[model samples]
Target: NKVSGSNAYVKSCRRDGVTRWSDGNTVSGCDGGEAFVCNSQMPWAINDQLAYGFAAASIPGLTEQQRCCACYKLDFTSGPVVGKSIIVQVVNSGPDVNPNQFDLQIPGGGVGIRNACSSQWNAPSDGWGQRYGGVSSRQDCYSLPAAIRDGCLFRFDWFKGADNPTMVYSKVTCPAELVARTECSRSD
Candidate 1:
């Protein structure tokens, strides 16, 4: 599918093996039927021009099971992140996600839809900022949990605070580092 404007956001992780449910049901590691984004799933830089991360996406013609652990290379074409690329592994699915859209898992990127950060990290009710978009500046990142603060900082430092940059994507082999983090691998 032709995907663009694949926005990135954070949704705390539960456990390594538990599959994310798009309906926002409680998985392992989170209490009260909340889904939490894992800190390990946070995007990290490989260099100035490249990086690796995880995301929740809806790829047309693919089942949620099929999208799990599948990796895609995104060639950003707009915003401050233009010309940069990031390899993202699908670890979750969003009910609100549109066809061919990916919601990247970036700390401090904002917890859209469901939120477990408050329960998981004692964060504010709406996370560090608005539920849909998140903290506006690097200084605002301090509001996030200390465990994920660096991941939040990544948005401003390595990512240049790019906002939902548009991009073209293609399937690629999952990187060893990403596989190690999610403990998932695609057979096909």
Candidate 2:
């Protein structure tokens, strides 16, 4: 077991008063932005070994500016949305929505309306029912929303049953593969 300060920076990252991610303030960026190494005896610390990644996506028609960065810690798929489908960027407001209800905001100050009727993950009486088994829809929904309104979000491809949209993602990556067919297309 080793102590900290072995090339470690002491810092924290927070959004809307809740910490999202963090590191020491002395640097511009992380050399490997995924997992960090604390002392082996550090309680509740994440493991160090990983294959990290960072990416961003912008929904053009929806006018959202989300500079998303994700780390592929354990062979997790990289996609338009690293954690959820309706990724969007808004001005100022973040993580402090009333009712503690999660909401997605588009660039034009438009609030995303969840198609509760059509949304695959939500049910009025789901003590155990879920598309991907979570308190919310993040664990479900294989499609990433580019445009959302009128009881439906414009997601080009959606997979049924499986948590990951491998087929759809593969199809979407096809064009990009043409740019470098011999290599794996980096998902962003």
Candidate 3:
């Protein structure tokens, strides 16, 4: 299935061991009480023109269970990353996500509605930057844990610091690399 729109933006979620519906267990480095965003959910560049990443999406008509682990090929139509494509696997979802939004899970990207980074990584209450848009520069990536710093840098480098680029998206097969990270596959 495919959907085209101008409302999409690659919002960032904070990194921590969060209990996501797709993966029932908490990722390492956080107490078991709350599930934070997994560090492995971070996005990475496959090449200058392409990338592979994970996102927590809200697609109208699909429940979280239906969306989890599903892959989408996003062809950017605007902003610095216009024309570049990224294949992202849906690993998380939330009620706050507006319809058609894919919140890319970048480490230094803002924590959105959650703040487990303070408990898991000792980050500030609002995370590395503004609560909604995260770290302003590549240098801020250094503040993230080593395991996820590369993903933060990816936003500044491969992603070209594009602020919420709009994209045309379609459902696609999940890549093995992404499946290996989330250990999830949609039954549908």
Best by TM-score: 1
lDDT of 2 by residue, 1-188 (tens): 11121222222222111232343442211222222211110111122221111112222232122111111112323454233232111111222333212222211112222122122222233222232232223232222222221111112122111233221111122222122211122234
Model 3 C-alpha lDDT per residue in residues 1-188, reported as the tens digit of each score: 11122112122223434333333443322343444556667798888898999887999898776777789999999999998999998866754578999988788888888666778788898989988899999998998888779999999999988888999899998888887666666545
In TM-score terms, candidate 3 sits at 0.82
lDDT (Cα, tens digit) per residue for candidate 1, span 77-128: 9999999999999877877788988888777778787776777777677778
- Candidate 3 lDDT: 0.76
- By lDDT rank, best first, the candidates go 1, 3, 2
Off by over 4 Å in 2: 1-68, 71-162, 165-188
Candidate 2: worst-modelled 10 consecutive residues by lDDT = 37-46
* Shift of residue 21 alpha carbon in model 1, Å: 16
What's the CA error at residue 42 for candidate 2, in Å?
35
Off by over 4 Å in 1: 1-35
Q: Candidate 3, clashing residue pairs? A: 17-36, 18-35, 18-36, 19-35
